[model samples]
Target: MGATQKMTIFKLCILAGAALVGTMSVAAQAMTPAQTMLGDAPSVPKNIVIMIGDGMGPAYTSAYRYYKDNPDTQEIEQTVFDRLLVGTSSTYPARVSGYVTDSAAAATALATGVKSYNGAISVDINKQTIPTIMEKAKALGLATGVAVTSQINHATPAAFLSHNESRSNYDALAKSYLTTDTDVMLGGGKKYFPVSLIEKFQAKGYQYLSDFNQLDSIKQGKVIGLFANVQLPWAIDDNDKNKLSKMTAKALELLSQHDKGFVLLIEGSLIDWAGHNNDIVTAMGEMEEFANAIEVVEQYIRNNDNTLMLVTADHNTGGLSIGANGEYSWNTSIIRGVQASPDFIANDALIHDDWLARVSLNLGFEPNEDEASQLARARMQGKEVMTTSIKHLIDSRSNTGWTTGGHTGVDVQVFATGPAASLFAGYQDNTDIANKLISLLPKAKSKSQSNK
Candidate 1:
């Protein structure tokens, strides 16, 4: 049979299975799509959590370990990543798009189990809408949510919850969310959502919030939280370094209330921003915040054994390397001393005549005469140049290296646990991850609801 014929048959089966579920016992209702398609299978998870560390490759994880290690200990400590390491996944997009995948394409493959062009969001190469796992889960009466450090309409979150020909269509992406059945969305994009649009969402019974402190006020029902105009402040510079973890915890508290289950997408979106800037200090801070969010999900999974959690990256950025300038050792002590992102430090320097003193205080070290002279010269040049100089100084001190400001084609590690996680235990393509998660979705009910 043709592929189209096969899909029709599959849909028919889902409809029939939905009918059978009404007559079956509660135990039978717990059967997953995999079990329905295949006679016998493992127990399906009640909840699914997928975490994406945007632009995090193998190098980022390795760098984070040393950055987080305790020098006082005789043995190196294990991170949440080391404890949950399972396999790796290749991050290449459609044949038309090249080997190095952008966030949109990579997220599309992870959300829909299909490959598309680099800028496409949940759409096939032909620009047709492709069904995402979120849509499928919502159709099956399960709660769906997205929490990230970036805006809710950003590439990673948009791919899972909406379809767009271009990821840059922010207004359309925001409008699309009004139609989706998503239960929770928390991030930074107040600028994109106007009062008129917010009113519409309120009419649909969705609570809209822009204050970061107000996240805890709403205990139940649908909510949209936009904390900043664009992406949240860099973790290194932000007052609340644990923002992502708090968002994850809030999403869980609301999503877990549904009887059927939920599927949530949480992203460390600013990790990619740090990678793009080649700022080691900022990258490490983002990694720690992301790790904190993982800890929250890990605890939730432990308390609720029926939930499965998967953590991976969209692609590697900056081609980050541990050592540079012919140095054999990387100095994590220097990185750990830095207190703010280069951008933040540079802006502060621009406003003060005592630029050198400010830089020294933030870096936690006094630069040598020659280094200080270069930083002073860059400050005279402008804020952009000053920021670059600060990053270079940190790279020199820490022996860090980066090949590019853009993404690199590299395989990313996959970590998983809980029910049916073994399917992700070996090397596979990015689409395979989505397919496995899709198989875990509860079969759709026979309601006349539209998933668009």
Candidate 2:
């Protein structure tokens, strides 16, 4: 057969398999109207908290469960936050143009209920701006907030709160936040907003707070806090002592003060960063900290029963492949030992040759002495060393393989437990999430009365 014929046959097989799987999943789990209306349908949730762990794929979630459930670690307590299902999306603008989605397009689907181009935000294929669920919720008298470990103007959070043609237009997007009535916005990206934009926010009745100390004074109304200039430090970084969870906890505290309830989107943005840099230690630590934030949300929902908490990711990154069956034995001690050593260099940073040599020594590997000497000299001259090879070596030694240092097409998982969670019982298009959320809102009269 010719190459074109073979390609055609392969695509047919894939379509057949997908159809069979979809039919089986639907047959196995059918929802009744009462079950579907558990949270929002019957009555709008008093509060909704959607947590996005950017680039958190099935591998990451499985790893988290393994560590949490392991008898030796007991890292986290058992809870009802365990049930999960896979999430899906037609992220590409055309069905024939199926491709792995970047954070921008995937988040646009989740936020605006539309699949847009890879770089588009809440705008549709024709570049028409769409009202995001956040905007709609705010219009309905529900207070809104967005918190992320990355720049607040990054693709994921910005998709819900801003509508620029490009995600790279951080400066303009940062300024747009002034027009939003979002109650408690907190995250990184101080540089995106110049002194003028800061002044604009202050003029618009927003109390701009840059430090965690100022959060305590925020009793109600709108507030914006920019902690770091860019993406925040990794959870393992000594500089991140304050931690991302602290910001999330504070946002939840303040948003809950609204009488009509609120909608807050919290993102573990650095998990994607670590994945892009192939930094296993940083990725694992961030995931743990994200779970800590989830615990806080779970506690709030447990007490307030009217709140709905949904946890998911925009897409998978790094195509993280766990375990090396015959090449290496996978054991907890081995993994821990590899992570404990200082020799495992992350490619995300620029280090000197002397530092590389020290890392090589710690890992019991003999690195190129000439290269090490050159790096040391460069460091003396205030030059940076590219540590790509060192990062690859460390990842190989740890037995954690990654297909590429980029996003993958694999579907991610979504876990939910609370009012309206039944709506998330099966595989769903990313846009379906937005539709379900909108359908859950109370009637217009109730919302208007709540505002009064």
Candidate 3:
């Protein structure tokens, strides 16, 4: 779609909420008639792949696009996915949940088609159980997979396979994985899976793989792999390069092996993490990496033709925004830094330990022994040297404002292609996501398999 055309549709969706002057400049660009018409509902795809960009909102997407399109100014364009769509509300009862929503509640709406209070997972406000798209797809004999950049048991992924009163019930939720016939379970949260439950998975004949190398060895059946104790690294980290996309590709490869089509939920969970930390560089880099995974899926869909790819976020984090007027050059540098950073950096602790030294080395401004000693003493006292530096760096970068380091109630953007893409058009409740997916799946012969 042309820039103008894309902005028009974006404005339409934005208008569904309160009008903000901030969105007007973007909306002035008209979308192509063909691109706008592409929103028309298409045939149901045989395979449904939902890519959840947890905590990414329109603001984040716009920032990424701005840097990507303006590559002449020294900013490296780093994006794998091209098309875009505006996302909708995950609010419950429409007006009851207010405009803001949390990940757990937003994910529940996306997964089960019902919005609940904040912190609830896969259940409605009344604490009632709801059928998820994955469960429905399974009953139709479709293969299923859930891949995330956070703990596999995190709220977004867990909403697809497990239900609980609180999203924090990692131990209880970890065990529920055993009952679901989900074909591929990838990402972090190794600690939540008690030793006994890990053994139980083994007993159930699941091929438990701990590393990416082991993924190649699995030829059949279900596979559960946890790459970290909690959340995985940001895509900008060199240490985690290719692991997230690798897991996504592997899951697609294995799940496609089944005679029946598959449904995969791939989450770029750390874009939200970076947002919470107000790390623009990290957030943009992770978004680019996640887009790479989308490209992989897009290629698969192109060949398969029967697969639908849906890209969206559960909620917005940090309410990220880009200034209309800024030194385009600095934005370019930041974008280049993001593109240069490999998929996944070293863990935060390792970065913390060596970051100062590395920055000093690269900038040719190392502190003297006395200054270093003072910094070490400050660190020993639990003070942050890097935090202070980052704040200064951010203040110098842009006039962008942030209300909180937490998730916002803003509507996220959703982009879809292939079959049933029209179902995503217009302003719809988050629960509509579940209903739309159910409509796309083949109807089951038994009532238990059908969504009421």
Candidate 4:
């Protein structure tokens, strides 16, 4: 009947990036699990499913909702987040040194309940390893797994699974997986792990799946899926079927076998990538993919009464702003008509004289002679320049505005449903997210205290 009784449920967190102002802020703390507010509350959660939308921001979701709601406009036809919206969380890292936080720090804060330095992964600015929620879940005998659209060793997921002073330690980060007996792992980034180490994993009884078809036949036990050599393609070009829904479905099916339940982190990693390009088509496509994954997770929660699902973003990306050129109203019809992302167009733009013409074909608007000239000039300059030009061209065509291709300091929304989901309401810092989740788990002495 009391609040503590509700804390015993499992948690599924899907980090969708939409804007909300953060109401509270806090300094970084050691990974000390908060003592139970209600002493009678259970410490163990049956399952925790967290899916982080890497660079999703408020404008991203706003545009998605508007476009979806206005058949002539939205990126997603519908989303579970519409009904489950909770609150927002501040994304700044541990210190006043900077306001905007990078993926590593934001994710580390979410994973360890600590505000780490900009590039730190599950480690504080002091360079000490901070124990993560996933680690705690695993230590308590709960199954742990991660399914992401990024390389398994990418910063966001790495913050949950590895600890390093530098997030760029791809080799070190990837190897850390061998040391941790995580139940299931899936994503791109085969290049990060060596052939020898991957072989060692198989020898250790880890089932390695290299494709979705291979993933389809998975029956049980620990799994490591490496679907690409690096980051997977945008959701629009996900012709190979490495869909987020499939990844989440497979992860849920496998992780649910644990008697103690599971803690699985599924990341819509490409959302950030799309944001970096300011590719609205790609961003919306990725949102749809993430939304589909949420739909699947929602079904899981429906069948399983004890599951708590949380969705939030690490940081907003691309400084995306809808209704560009001071328009009183924006048109969703443009977004609705696009068949391919600018990233795809940029790639095809190369090796063709009429690439802008091709872009018009895919985007439903043709560039003027001056715009086409700029694209040709950019193509002559290099890939980076050409890509920028392509995105700018899309911006010109669709009137989608962006301030930056990098991450922003804006607050992001956190949506939740299930028992104890109300604990996540209000303006909290990113660390509060991990801290709240930790409170639901059995109180353990702080890792810092352990050394003492």
The numbered model that scores best in lDDT is: 1
Tens-digit per-residue lDDT, 1-452, candidate 1: 99999999999999999878756634533342222323333467889999999999999999999998999999889898887777899999999998999999999999999999999999999999999999999988999999999999999999999999999999999999999979999999998999999999999999998899999899999999999999999998988889999999999999999999999999999999999999999999999999999999988876787888899999999999999878799999999999999999999999998889999999999999999999999999999999999999999998999999999999999987677766686699999999999999987655455444
Estimate TM-scores for all models: 0.89, 0.79, 0.79, 0.85
Superposed by TM-score, candidate 2 places the C-alpha of residue 338 at a distance from the truth, in angstroms, of: 6.4
Count: clashes, candidate 3:
16
- lDDT for each residue of candidate 2 in 107-132, tens digit (9 for 90 to 100): 88888888888878788878889999
Poorest 10 consecutive residues of model 4 by lDDT? 27-36
Q: Which of the two, 1 or 3, has more TM-score?
A: 1
Q: What root-mean-square deviation over C-alphas does model 4 reach?
A: 10.1
- Model 2 spans with C-alpha error above 4 angstroms: 1-44, 67-97, 239-242, 325-328, 331-386, 446-452
Model 2 residue 434 CA deviation in Å: 1.5
Score each candidate by Cα lDDT: 0.92, 0.72, 0.72, 0.80
Q: Sorted by lDDT, highest first, which candidate order results?
A: 1, 4, 3, 2
lDDT score of residue 87 within candidate 1: 84
- lDDT tens readout by residue for model 4, 51-136: 78888887877888866774544354545666666689999997843989999999999999999789999988889999998989
The numbered model that scores best in TM-score is 1
Cα-lDDT of candidate 4: 0.80
